[model samples]
Target: MVQKYQSPVRVYKFPFEMVMAAYEKRFPTCPLIPVFLGSEVLSESASADGSTHVIERSCKLSVDAPRLLKKIAGVECVFFIQKNTLSWRDRTLLIEAHNETFASRVTVLETCSYSVHPDNESWTCFEQCASLDIKSFFGFENTVEKIAMKQYTANIKRGKEVIEYYLSELMSEGITEIPRWVPPAERSSPSKAASPPAAPSSEMPAAALAHQSPRLQMVSWGPDKLDADYIERYLGRLTPMQESCLIQLRGWLQETHKVKIPKDEHILRFLRARDFHIEKAKEMLCQSLTWRKQFQVDYILETWKPPSGLEEYYAGGWHHHDREGRPLYVLRLGQMDTKGLVKALGEEALLRQVLSINEEGQKRCEENTKIFGRPITSWTCLVDLEGLNMRHLWRPGVKALLRIIEVVEANYPETLGRLLIVRAPRVFPVLWTLVSPFINENTRQKFLVYSGNNYQGSGGLIDYIDKEIIPDFLGGDCLCQVPEGGQVPKSYYLTEELENLDHIRLWAETIYQSAQVSKGAPHEIMIEIVESSSVITWDFDILKGDMVFNIFHSKRTPQAVKREVSSSVPAVNNEQLIDRSWVLGVDYSIVESPLTCREGESIQGSHITRWPGIYILQWRACGPTHARVDEVLSSLQGSAPKCKVMYYTEVLASHDFRGSMTSLESCHSRFSQISVTTTSSSQSQDGSLISR
Candidate 1:
């Protein structure tokens, strides 16, 4: 975005970022020798009644902006930047000028510091422009900028290694540096490489720069005048180069994320964001990235398989996890489980079930109600919830949570003053498990339930409710009372069941889960087997980190590199299953022009530039190639842009080595042809099949 100078503007932007942004804006794709003066935040101070801040004594390089501007204009050159190292206060004007006769033209500074106040002084000082030495400022600033650019260039070399290694592993083709990186002395000069100046006129067509919203000021980029948000999305808005880099780094995501930048983008958005603000460098990677699996994640709470008996307890019932699914946030209802607790808070069924009453089973679930004055809709899907820990940024710790709340209020105004808490037993377990895969390990272990209240402690929401009243909430005893199996005994019904409390609760929540689809990560996937529906859930995530997260999410189909290893492959033991099937994902990845291979002692430049060789596939639903599907995938791997294979079914929690690769693959296939659809629940089945 550019600014139309109503006046030959001499304004300096704050937050110290405009220095670089200003140059880029004014020059726009033109090669300019950007000179840096000093490392400091230069704030133009203001008198109490001032309309604008002046270049004050507090500024690092104190030359007045107006005087600096006139000098460059007098030179009759199109120099994009001017900076100073000393104030006109020293009876000297520190100044530097770019000789725009050529791009990266032969340049030098004309220092004019005369009666220089010593560097260390106790008093405020100001020397007029005519009485000051300005050339020295240019010299010092240029030297610093050159040194910094050199360091930055060196770091880029180091980064190249990572990109090359991954890319060479796949494409095997040599990665080369872009020609502009070399210094003029070492590089082919303009005679060899065209470093021509870009069009100076802003009257160029919108397409010449890029499409812009009518509201966006696109004439020039004045760092001072530009909002921070505008700066953030500015780079994204740039065409060709930006879009091209996206295709390389993001691959298939280009269609959906075609850079719909927001208005008034953040000027310093990249500082605390990914890569420490090295976005300029990252965009120029040489190779495609490599990812372990074709990671598939759907945003929107979809997979609607609610825990047995809890489906009816939610607001949205068990809407299949989909982009448009309505939300159903689970609230773990809890209270103390002591004998007398039920008599007070629990219903009569408490006396019959297990001689005990639990709020999870006793309480009536109010579907999508504004209970506690909060609007929360828990979406249900038959998802295989591994886990969720708020420790991850999304569901962070209390401190982070508080910050999130504040952000919500500040950014999402409508959500302000709303207290969001989950206060239901069935709700808490799902919330914890859903967020588990994304959080840190410690956070995963400490995953807390959404019990809706503000009291704090270690246990799940039940623990919070337990202390509040004989809270009819819940846990297992500390004795070595391990169930027959070592896992948490989710199969046992420990709540009051006599008065049909469990049955009633089930009927209510099932109706709730049947509500709507949400546009969030699908939390569950369920398939029916007779009257019982088996549920599997998927967690959605966009890795916001460099390297690990980047590669993990990038995908490349094996369309270019097919292998015949699925069949003729022996069955896998539990451990092998972890690595070969679920871990490796049944599909194969492609190694591009540069064949992925083992390295030798001799050095080869094949891994020269690419960061990684990953290619993302935009797939909606898919699963591993079944034994029958295997033959099809094998034949089509390198032929089709995409291939869907079929596999036999196997029990996969433990071992798939029983010669039933079909069954094993079934357990871990990309998609089980998984209906993930709602069906007539077995609430009316003969046996009480629901697990409390």
Candidate 2:
């Protein structure tokens, strides 16, 4: 595999002419760059008016590598051919280099440029890109690549300091600036008539500087013009490699995507999500971009409008700034009727509302970045869950919330800077249990949950938000305009016909599967739980009939049912299911109490798995049944049992599931697309489930 690097445009607070003079001082022999032994001029050229000068040299550099590798390569030094084109008229210097040593086994190409900043004439901009390809390194390709990249990154860092060193040296010598080259005819008469300075004894032959290359036109960057200053000011400070990833990904999007590329802040989120792995981040970003375009999400904020019902009853709105100037959003979730809202507007409307909030949040982040004179790319949310209870734990509503959380987490990584859950009630645990698996661990770490008067003390909301800006309900002075969340009347719910129409939209956004369970034949999902204390979560709706939901753990594996891995969820595979013949209590035991869900009711809950074994999630028709499977199977031949359900299940580890974000496969509705693996640290796991 070939490796590549591209640096963001770096700005120097000096004129291009002055910078170029500093740059020239490093050539031939510079003690500042010890590895750069020396260079022999292969060729040199200049424009007729002396506005352009081109020099080609064969450079020799000491190889910074292990003695064993050096002995194998049979060389202590490496040779490279460098080409430098200096355009005095345009105030630009372009350098291209390629290695000559080990040409048959490896190839390295680098390009560097120093030019006048487009928007500022007094400053210079520098950009660098390089690629290393090892075609046939004998048994050391990976080691060689790692060493090469480390060296390249180190050199890049030193390159800046080297230029600064030369710049300072020139300033000390009173050669702070050099006059820009001009045509002879344009020069003043006295200057033109002045005697020409004698060339240095070490200067290259004049004949070598006779040839001319074409004028070097600076390639304009894309529509989303990003510069060093802009990146630092708005996108925060990224490491050199991270900056390269952002630039490369943005350039790829600009080339392939016709629509407006996401802003730097948006791109940075995806980059951070993938931990600055350029290719991985690019893959994720492309998917998100496609999703945005497919859904016309760019126009969501402009096209979406809240219904009067939501405007009056929804418990969330933008409040004042947080202590860090993050746009503050207050959500009184416990007091709000999530079930009522879902019934009235259906899942689709609520989803759109959530997306709109995210969009507004991004805009607010940008506004605050300027207002605070720093990067503020995400918002802080204050969730007051004082009145949360069983009523809020409506199954379908919880499912809707999980679906929304999934969508937001996927498309809006790193958007929630902090979460302040104050006045958290006992029922909050139930709600958290159902939803926390879908939340990123990074985001979860930002959660500051406060119960009762715990938030009024020293380590509470005041630490994050100013006391004066706290909402009135929280016993603060501010009169928050956010609605006082209340239950929406059942009468306001849309007709069943309207809800069905909205379900189509909701279905497309989720990764759930549906299955029908008959009385004699229960639909059982077999999950191989390899980690004790992990949480098994489920969300299901009794679409056509009543059903009983039960969770069981069996020492005996069930029959191997081929697991159908879905594409959207990456990590699933066709693994063998646990074997059958597992007797209750003897080989298997019920871990959760059986809950009978009525027809048209939605259910969401989770269980803490106590043992590492095959766990079965079974949904059966809610009615009288035989005591044994043989008795139930024996009666199935005479009559057909009817029942149906749609459910989704997820196996969440108590600790962080290493590579789970990149590898896990998931689905929605009946069969969950969760593909949990058992390879992770136990200390990072959160085993409990909660709902509010």
Evaluate all candidate structures by whole-model CA lDDT and list the values in order: 0.23, 0.70
For model 1, what is the alpha-carbon lDDT of residue 384?
A: 17
lDDT of 2 by residue, 79-130 (tens): 7777877777777777877767777777677677788888889899988766
Off by over 4 Å in 2: 27-32, 43-52, 65-77, 184-225, 505-692
True-structure Cα RMSD, model 2 = 20.2
As a TM-score, model 2 comes out at 0.66
In model 1, the Cα lDDT at residue 124 comes to 17
Candidate 1 achieves a global lDDT of 0.23
Give lDDT tens digits, candidate 1, residues 55-166.
2111111111234532642432222123333221222223322222212322222111112224323211121111001122233334433332333233222322332343
Instruction: Give me the candidate number with maximum lDDT.
Output: 2
Determine which window of 10 residues in candidate 1 has minimal summed lDDT.
599-608
| lDDT of the structure predicted as candidate 2 | 0.70
